[model samples]
Structures are given as C-alpha cells and as structure tokens.
Target: MIHDTNDAIPHQLIHDALERVISSREIVNSDRKKRFLQFIVKETLAGNADRIKAYTIAIDVFNRDSSFDPISDPVVRIEAGRLRRCLEHYYLAEGAADRLQIIIPKGSYVPQFVMREVAAPTLLRALDDDKQSTSERLPEIVPAEAEFSQAPVAATSSYQPPGTAPSRVPLLKRPRLLAGLCSLLAILTIALAGTTLFQRYQVSVSSRAVPSQVPTLMVLPFENDSSDPAQNMFAKGVTEEVIGALILFKNILVLGADTSFQFRTETALRDAVPNVPIDYVLKGSIDRTEGQIQVNAALLRAADHQYLWSGSFRKDFTSKSMLDLRRDIATQVALILVQPHGVIDKAELQNTVGRPSESLTSYECVLRTREYWRQPNAEMHKQVRTCLERAVRIDPDYADAWAALAFIYTDEARIDFNPSAERPDPTLTALEIARRAVALAPDSPLPLQALGIAHWLRREPALSIAAYEQARVLNPHDSDILADLGRAYSLTGDWEKGIPLIREAFDRNPAQPTWYRLFIALYHYVNGQYAEALAQAQKIGTPNLVYTHVVLAMIYGQTGDRDNADYEVDEILRLYPNFGDKAVFEFERRNIDPAIISRMLDGLRKAGLDMDPDREVANEKD
Candidate 1:
C-alpha cells in the first residue's frame, strides 16, 4: 500500500469530506467551524515541510488573514490546540495497521507520514522496542483482549454516553485515532492552498537581488520654506540639479526626479522607499525669508534611518545670483553623498566649472517643455519647440538646453511634422549645436548623449554607438543614455545586445513615457517575433495607445487574421482622419521593415483607404 501511494485520489472525495466537516453541527458553531476550515486549508498548502516548528507555522497563518486581529483574538494559537486533539484520535483506530500513517505530532505544524520500509532494519528495530515497552507498561492482571472488548462503545458513536463527559477518554485510541489524523492532515492541506492563492493577488510584488558592487541612492524633494508661494520652483530646481549631478556616475543608481518628487507628501521616510532597494537617501530643505536664502541638507543611511552627515548654508538672496547658489549646493551635496563610498573623489566633485549652470529661468523652461512633450500632439510639439528655443536663448552656454533643442528638432524630422517646410534642416543644426556642447564640456555625459542622438538621426549607427558607449562610461546610472544606446543597437540589427540594455532601463524607470515601450515593440516586431511584440505593446498605458493597435493590426495580418486586422485599420483611420498613404510612407522611411509596411497597407486598403500612386512608387524604389 505504501508503494502505491503515488496513485491518484479523487478530488471530489476530498472536497466532500471538507464540506461535511465545515457543515457538521456536533463540532462547534458555524462561524468557528468556517474559520477553522479556512485556516487548515491554508496551512497544508503553504507551510514549508522542512521547517515544521509550531511557531513558524503560527506566524505564516496569522500573516495571511488581515482581519485575524492578533491583539484581540489569538485565532492561530487556539486552532492549533484543537487540531492536535482531532488528529490524535484518527490515527489510533482506522489507521493502526495501514501502510500509510499520517501524524501531526504535538508542538509541530508540519504533518509527518510514515510508510513501510523493507530495507531499513534500524526503523523496524525502533518500532518493535516501542511496542514491547507499551505492553510491559500495561497491568499484567488484566488481559489485553478483555480490556479491548470492555472499552466504551460511545467512542465510535456521534452521541456521548450518559453521566460521562465527552473529554474524559484519550483522543488517541484504537478506532478513533485514524479519524483524528485525517482531520489534521486535511486541515493543513487546505491552509497551505489558501495562503498560496492569497499571495498571488498582490500587485507589483517582485524578488530581485541588488548587485553588491553598485551604489544606490534616493533623492527626496526639497522642502519649500519661503513665505511667497511663487518661490517654490526655485527649491524644486535645486533638487533636480543634485539628481542630474549624481546621474553622471556610472556605478550609481540615482532615482530620477519624477519618481523622487512623489515622496514629498509622505510623512515618514520608510513610506517613500517602496520596492526600490537602496543604500542611502538624501534629503534637503530650502528657506527664503527677508531677502535671505538658507539651505539645509543631510545624508541618511537607509537601513538604520540615521543621519550620517549634514550641513547648512546661508546667502543673501537679493544680491547673490540664484543660479550660482544652486550650483554650489549641487556640488556640495554630490561630494558629501559619494565621498564615503570613494566613488567620486573630492577633486572630481570640486571641478564643476564646465558643468551646466543651475539657472532658475532655464530650469523653468525645460520643465515646461517636458510637460508639452508628454502630450504628443501637433500643438504640444509646437509649444515644446518654443519653450526649448527660449531656454537656449536665456542661457546660450547651457549644455542641457542645447541638448533639448537638438532632441526636439530631430524628433520633428523623424515624425514628419513639417514636411512642407524644407524639413527644417535639423541634421545640420543638431550636429553643429551638439559639437559646440561637447567642446564646452568634454567630460560631461550630457554633451556625449546629445552627440549620439545627432549621429543616430544622421543614420551613422557606428558613430552613434561609440558616442553612447562613452556616455555610459561617464554616467552608467543615466537611463536616458542607456535607452538611446539600446535603440541604436537595435536599429543596426543587433537585437541581442539591444534587448538587455532596454530591459535594464525599463527596470530602473518603469513609469517612463510610452516612447520606450514603442521602441521595444518595434525591436521585437522587426525580428518577426509577433507574440513578444504584442505583449510589450499591451504594457504601454498612454493616450497614444493607437500606436499599439496599429502594431497589433500588422501582427494580425501577418498571422492570417484578416478580419481582426481590417477592424484595427478601420479604427486607426476613424481616430485620425488624415492618416493616409503619406503617414504610412513617413513611418516606412524611418527604416521600419517593408514586411510590416506591406501588412499594414493591405489592412488599410481593405478598410477603404485610398493609396497614393507617387507614395507607392517611392516605397517600391526603397
């Protein structure tokens, strides 16, 4: 029988037994029975077999039930005590001579099963010794058979004997012990299953190890201390500058300003650090009163919540330039945060001459441009271009301002926003401005990243990769630089190298705009991996989900789903009426695969979209 334990049992039988136990009136009240049943099911499924200790099992069960109210009712501890008695009776009677024996020993949550082992002489010897000892302990005057026959018959019945208490007899008896063992094992099985099901309901739960060699830090938003509400932007600008400075280190993981700013409303530091496992946190506050500006900052250990270093600085706000003061604070903060790790030496942090200026006006313009860029519409594009132009005009030498201008122009050319205006000659303008930026600050990664983008737009994949590689060396923590490099590698048909880099960027910044997801999908689609491409496209949660639908249409067409593909094409045209041959041609010219183009065109044509003769000729030539 033990050798046949691998045989399958009917699931219906187990379910029926569980239902009967839960509904039985002889045990306890309805509510108590229900709770007990639920706990037993959860335990049997989730409790680790290797760690059978009672306390461990209690903690596991209590943690799962949010309403258990550990302070008020000790449900886990009380249930364990009752379960032990129920199990003892089941094993003694029906299971006494069975090949398989289930036992839930006292002071242990994990159940143990015993089976016949023909080869283990030591085990057999131990069992024989125990039997002899039990026989000797019994009184010699009373015969064993007579004592067995004289045992009360009430033990096997549901009703108790008159004038005798139900709890008087020991639970571990001949016929009743089998029932007790089954009860305990069944309850534990249910408990284990319930716990596993509950854990699966949580969101964003991940178990990833952080590399020991990489340094990680979180920068909190700066506090606003000025009486005038208008001065809030200045403090915000200072916070962003520190983030930008630390991002220049390749061996660091600096949380971006967009994610870090959300922590401002959190009352405690622990509340801000979610799944982002980091080594340190940097916090600061700014005060502006009576024409004076004061900034206070501190570096804290994330594990112990202790302030490792702190400092305060004061300057006359009316006389001293705000940009200069911000630059001083950014440099000081970087030095203090990285000095202990010995990653950024004192000399390197002190040499901040050629770095981008922390001008308040330029900072405001960049912030506004970022907002407009997120809209992804023609009007928003125009607004962002204007803002970026003003940022460059305000601070002509600012490297970040020049980079932003170059990025916007290249994007406009790629998207064909102004096909009638001589294409704006963006390549020439981007190349020249990017070169000037590199000349001003040769070591800074910002200029290098800009140069890489310019080369990428010019179709110089090798040069673009080299520039991005240099940028990565200067600032490994900059997700933007890594993402751009990944894109360049994909465009050059190096999908293997591109996928890992893009995935790392996604892990670091999960809430970025849809542009990253779109690129990742393109990489998969172009490689003929339709399923992977569709999966990634579905992850994108932006208003421009239309792009995902367009990709899906192409995928469906390739896979021979003509009806679904046609429906997708119709929806795209309905949403954007002007979407026509020109729109398709513009997308195709950007090195998008001709196979994808043919599929999309076939779906659109089936949906009543008129094809332009000239555009078809150009596509054929390509």
Candidate 2:
C-alpha cells in the first residue's frame, strides 16, 4: 500500500535500490556509513526530506549535542561529503545496473530517486518477437486499397486554345466516381486494420509467457571474486543471509533450496532459470584485495533477461566488519523488497542475531547449523546437532548455540527419535540448557523460543505460553514464532486465539514448511476436524517426518479409516517398538498431560496397535 512520494521513484523500486546500497559490500563493511545511509533514507521517507540538513544529521545520526555548531565544527559537512562521494562511487561501481537511483543532491540532505533505463537490445528483441507473431497471423489481411487500387484517369477538359476562340470549360469539376470509390476503400481499410490490431492485442495477452501473480525472487550463490578461495564463505554467507531476510516479506515468494540448488554460476542460472518462471534473479560476488573488500551485486528480470539493478560496495576489512557484513546484506535486501515500512527493527535484529561475535568459529558454526536445520533429513539433523555442539563448546556464552541445542534435544522426545527404552532421559538436560540460554540472553527471542519448547516438553503449558508470548514480543514478524506461540495457545485450550495466529502464519509464508503443516494439522485434530486434519497431515512431505505420522495415524483412527491408521501405527511401532512400556510411561507421566496421553492411547487402540510385549496397558496408569 505504500506508494511513491510525489514523482519520485515508485515506492517499491525505491526500496529495491535502498536494499542494493545497504547490502553493497561497501556499506556492510563500514558500519558508520551503513547507519548514516539508513537514518537519512528513513528521514527522507518520513517527509522531513528537505528539512534534514547538516545540523540535524549531526545531532541525530552523529549524536552531537546542542553545543555543536554547524559552522565552527564541520563534522556534518565532512560526513555529508563522504556520504555523497560514497553514493556516487556506489552507483558508478556496484550500483551501476540498479533500476532506481537515489541521490542526495549537492548541498542538500533530501534524497531524490531516478529510475534506470533498460537496454535497447532487450527491448528491441521483445518488440521484434511481437511483430513476428503479428505478421504471421495477418499476412493475408493487406489493406484493401493496396490489394485493389483504381488506376488514376486524367480529368477530361473542354477548352479552346488561347489564340483561337473561347469554348465552354469547367475549371474544377468533382470526380464523383473516383471520390466515391476512394471513400469506400478507406472505410474498409480502417475496419480491417482495427480488427487486426485488436486480434494482435488479444493474442499478446493470451500468449504472455509468465504467470501473473505475486513476484518471486531466486537468490543464487554469490561468486567469489576474491583471490583466496577461503574468502568465498563471505560471498556464500551473504547470499544465504539475503535469502533469509527476503523470506520475511509476506508479499514476495522466495524459491526455497530445492529449486535454487543448481544456481551456482552465471552459466547455470542463465541456462536453468529460463525454463523456470521467476520474476527476478539476484546474483552477486565478493572481492577482497589487500585490506579492503568490495561486493558487487545485481538483480535481473527473468522475463526479459534485463539487468534491473547492479551495485558494488567497498570497505576496509576487520574481523568485526566481516561478522556484520552478511546480516547487513540480508537486512538491506528485505528493506528493498518491502521498503521504508519494512526496515527491520534494529532492536529485534540485535536480539535475534546477537551483538558482534567474539569468536568466528562460533558464528560460522551457528550459520552452518541454521542451514542444516531447514533440511528434513536425518543426516542434516545430525549435522545441525554437531554444529551446535561445537559452537557452544567454542563460546560458552553463545546463547543461540545453546538455544538450538536445547531445541534439538526436546525435539528428539517429541519425534520419539531417542525413545525411552533406547536412550537415556534428555528432557531434564534440555530444560536445563534452555534455562541457561534464557538466563544468558534474556533479550533474544530464539532462546525464549527454546525455553518455551522445553517447558512444553515438560508439560508446563502455562510457562510455555508465557515464554512464547515474550518471544512473540521480541520478534513480532517471525512466522515460526507466531505458529509456535499459537500452538501453545491452542494446547492450553485457547482455540479462538490460536487459530487466528496459525492463519496469520500461513498468510505470512506462502510456502509453509512441513513443520508448519504438522502444527496446523495438530490444531485441526485437536478441534475435532479429523478429515481436515488428515488432509493437512498428508501435505507434510519432509524426508524425516516423525510426529507428523503420529498425527496422521490419530486422524485416520478417529475418522474410522482403520487400514490407514493401522499402517501408520505399524510405522510408529517400528520407530518406537516399546512405546507403552513402563520406562516410557514414567517419562510420559513426568512430561505429558493425562488427557493428551489418554487421547493418543485411545486412537492407537482403535487403530489396532498393541501394548509393549513385556507389559500390560492397564499397568501404565500405576
């Protein structure tokens, strides 16, 4: 709904340009410059565009007090000059291909936007294709005058020679026959041309190559322009971060890993993406030379293969700079997609990403873990766990690492991955670790999220809901957190509040994950929509589905689909053969509600599932 201000760059395009500038390696590598860019743009967007001058910038962005003088101290002027040259360099360099141009004119803080022009070659090609199609369809529909023209006849003149005698002569006589014939031809020609043109328009519209829907983005793995191959991580990391950030925009559909997995090189993308209908393709590279680093990136419209925007940023290298670079790119990308209103709250970012990492290993490990966590494969989960463990060991104060570890442990119990008979109790350890994470980073939502999950596993729904609510406050836009909080609300018997939250999650993420599907299915099952719940459960196509199968089994059993229910029960038994045994029952008693336990057992009984070989089901209550 946010529109362009005045005749300036359209609101959406302006956001895309801002994203380009902020993510430019130059901005990401320099924190001060990035902050300056963000504040000035924000101010401009807020309509104080012209009013923002040296004095205000100094006082607001530079933190100069009232005692600061514009004339006496040239901090604002100097910084402004630096900012100007930086922008100029950015556009001429990294931002060269950007469709929108944002300029802070000389001697003014107000920003003006200019949209870039696409290349003529691409335009000409599109036009040629259209003409070819039209020509093919209308080859025989030539104008009637061209097809049947009357030969011109000289006007018959009755006159006498000047020297001889005068004779009756008509100086101007209308050629009635010729005029009438020409008029009739003109009318027919007009009608035929109009019909042909309309048909061309209809054909063009009907044959349009791409689908009309929400715009989609596919971010490719960035190339390493750096001399050292090890530095490729910076580019790859930035690419991953951009994907993460852009996914938050509810309006944009980001193609997840599978569809984008092969897009590693320019050649690969150019060759592969033509077959796929994508709105835009983002490609970038990281270059490091001596102490300075430069990142160059561009967005291309997939339909025409035209570059929409391109930019390069340069900055001096520092460990801290490297650490901040990836996230800054992501934040910038998101802002570009949604614009002024979509600027990620700095406080939330701080809470989620944490302050600069003291240890690179911990940071890198956590990044790798997050990558693996998205995969629905056992190998990926194993890698996720290993990475988290290594990260926490490297930096004991790494709250994100501890939070992830605890979540994984709690998840093992939920999925029966490490059932009671096969493995030692992990719920207590997971709960303790979650507590440690919350104590260490009270401001972070991730740790709070983990704390909530741990409490839920321990059957303390009140504590779980409280933790989830707080987490929601810390990160209001996060879909996963919303869904989790809603699940907690529903589990505590607040279906009215919970259902809306789940619906919001679906709205936010057009391509909801398998986990999301399971959560929604569970909510439906609890609400007694057995058929809907079964349908939702069937949509979970994750390679490592666990608890989803149980939900499916229960839904089927409740709906009297005994064969399917028994099939699911057999799968569960194979996973946890001693599910109803004494050890498992004791563990369940400590962490599960009686009502939930009874419901699960009832469904399984209906599905013809058997008690553990060594124990009677009635003894479990004791």
Query: How accurate locally, in lDDT, is each candidate?
Result: 0.53, 0.57
TM-score result, candidate 1: 0.41
lDDT of 2 by residue, 379-475 (tens): 5555556556655543444556677777777756665443333225456556556655655544456766787787677666666776777666544
Using Cα atoms with residue i matched to residue i, what is each candidate's TM-score against the true structure? 0.41, 0.42
Report RMSD (Å) for each prediction in the order shown: 30.3, 31.1
Clashes of each: 30, 12
Task: Name the candidate that leads on TM-score.
Answer: 2
State the lDDT of candidate 1 residue by residue for 1-622, as single tens digits. 2211233433343344445444432122324335554454434434435553334444554444434443334344445544544343222321233334434455554544445344232211332343254247533421222111112122121111123343444543322344446446645765877653222211111111112223467788888877777567678767867876675453345666655664443234335334445666788889988887999888776667777778888887852366567766776566445522232322222333234333224544444444444445555566556655655543444455565666666666665443325335666456455555554444456656777777667655555677687666555655666777887776555778876788877655443345667668767766678788777866765544356556666666666667777776776666555666575655554544455456556644644456664565234445
